[model samples]
Target: MSITRRTFALGLTALGLSACTNQVLRTAPRGAKPVAELPADLRPTPNPGYTDWVQGFKSRAAAQGITETTLTAAFRNAGYLPGVVDRDRNQVEFKRSLEDYLAIAASDERISKGRAAFARHRTTLNRLESTYGVEAEIICAIWGLESLYGERRGNVPVISATSTLAYDGRRGALFEKQLLAALQILQSGDITADRLTGSWAGAMGHTQFIPTSYQAFAVDYTGDGRRDIWSEDPTDALASTAAYLQKNGWTRGVTWGAEAGPGAPAGRIIQPQEGGPEFSVTRNFNVIKRYNNSDAYAIGVGHLSDRITGGGPLRGSFPPDAYGLTKDDRITLQQRLAAQGFDPGGADGVIGSKTRAAISDYQARNGLPVTGEPSRDLLRRLG
Candidate 1:
């Protein structure tokens, strides 16, 4: 999962150059105002074609029993945020090696806290497990990863973010639907407009549930007539996550998979592509994938859950050259390659086929192995 040189280059290309944007900032004039501080009216406007989308959102919210008072109160001062769109549209650089990803995502800090939380809330977790048929560790692992158990829910207003994304006309329909769901949540008095904040991409709550996800899966476990995923009490959020997995087909009792030790027989080895990484990947694992459709993410959740329950790290090893590279290093490599005209497509730090191809081309020209795997030796040549 290391970010290759090509991935980094693509990120830079997206920003109109193959250099680190942050570096450019450091060299800029000292008096320059930050992009985020510009006047509101001067900011990016909605695409004209999305007027219909706004109207549609209003209509849907009304039909879903969201009052006009709630909708107006939520969106009255909302404005388009082009920066949010830019951030969402940007591709992520998967530069963390499996070990690094696991270490951070399933770190000891998380495990210790998770164990303590489990002990304190054993009654609630056990009740949820029996009622919903979802394991406590999986729930806790997701809770830890999504917002560090509600310690850092994002500050972007869900209503405004979804409205802005909808108005931007790139996936307008999707955002519009989310906007309606958000209004419904407000109407139901589950969360007030001022408290409804989340990621710029519109996922909210301790578990980062999108508005649509809230509509479809939120649970009022405490029976207070509201599903309060954002409150200090995480009962609703945890229960909702469990319900989501259960509804999506979580198996009762199976591990996600463990690594086969290097010393094991050849038949025990799980190959990378076809039969790689002999993971147990139960039904719940698939449900986790539904939350974010990435093998790395699902693996992170599963592994973190195992760790919480006293499991250890993988015993087998990844490919020899696949050292976990940091995000910054991948960006550096991509910038270096693009400067030399290898054209890895932009400096995003993801090792896509183009990046691999660029690496192969660079290796062939330099009389190297042409294996397309990045290394310190190739980096020296590129430098």
Candidate 2:
């Protein structure tokens, strides 16, 4: 799955805040410390109800067959992360245009890197594809998108993040289940407690599999005892991602979809937005959706994979965005919005929730239609 702004933000925030713990663990290696005896510096600031929640969850986890040692190691210094709650409660608006998404997912630089990475790992990817019946480029596309070819695997402690979300009580059952899965991963000895780090939401490894996803689909591709997705080697993660897609119905030798011109073969067609490049997708496209459950994301992966494998860009021209702005114009709009103190997250030419909210507030104050779409008129007015 491609890392969206929300996931990227979650990763960045988690890593940024974990500086203390990372440093401490670097100097003083953690042993089998009891939850209470763990150093305060190792934990986030606990809320009033957090301790009780942990104790209750401890009992439940014990009942679920997680050993006492596993529970203690997993929760040694865990506490509620306020940032996780903020991210969960207010997910970034998922209004990025396909163009915006591709600008990051399949940028020229990214395509170059993807090609290099594909070439570098061709032998291993070939074997995996032959074994799994999933395409190598697709796996490479996911690798590029999820962690930029292993450039940005997150650094947050998975147990802490999931346990915090579990105790936070908003999505208690889901996070509790995830926390249990994390403990299981620890018990299995793939990765240790200190090294079991990932996104703020607990998506781990190269392709960002959550704890449950890892348990269900992770593979030991290298004949090693561990399905070590965190190591420098990307074989297991890529193989695991392929296994997942295969399990979910990736048709062998079938493409996800393709760009179509006028009078193209009729299938399940999706344009993403009005007057954009159209795709004649297949069941394989839906299979890609199981990875991220977003049309734009699936297309980005498919198209980028195609590009990585030497395919050209779409021939059909995308009409103006809903706001009557071209892709370049949208980039300008994002820059202008940020310049005016309305941060649309990053100036990546995407009109996500933050951008829409900022635009709405601007419109409400200035007597314009509250349409969240960016327009030439809005850009000029901001100017």
Q: Write the per-residue lDDT of candidate 1 for residues 1-383, one digit (tens) a residue.
A: 12211221233212111122211101212121233543453244666554565667778777877788997888765556666678646645434344434545665666787777777777888889888888888888888777766665555667767888777766676677777778888888898787787655666776768787788888999999989998878899999999988877887765554554443323222233332355544455556767655555677777777777787766544443354454445657778888887877666555555667788888888787879876766666777
Q: How much lDDT does candidate 2 score?
A: 0.74
Question: Model 2: per-residue lDDT, tens digit, 209-323?
Answer: 8888888899999988999888788999999999999998998988887887664445698888676678898888888777766787788888889999998877877667667
lDDT of 1: 0.65
Q: List the residue pairs that clash in candidate 2.
A: 93-353
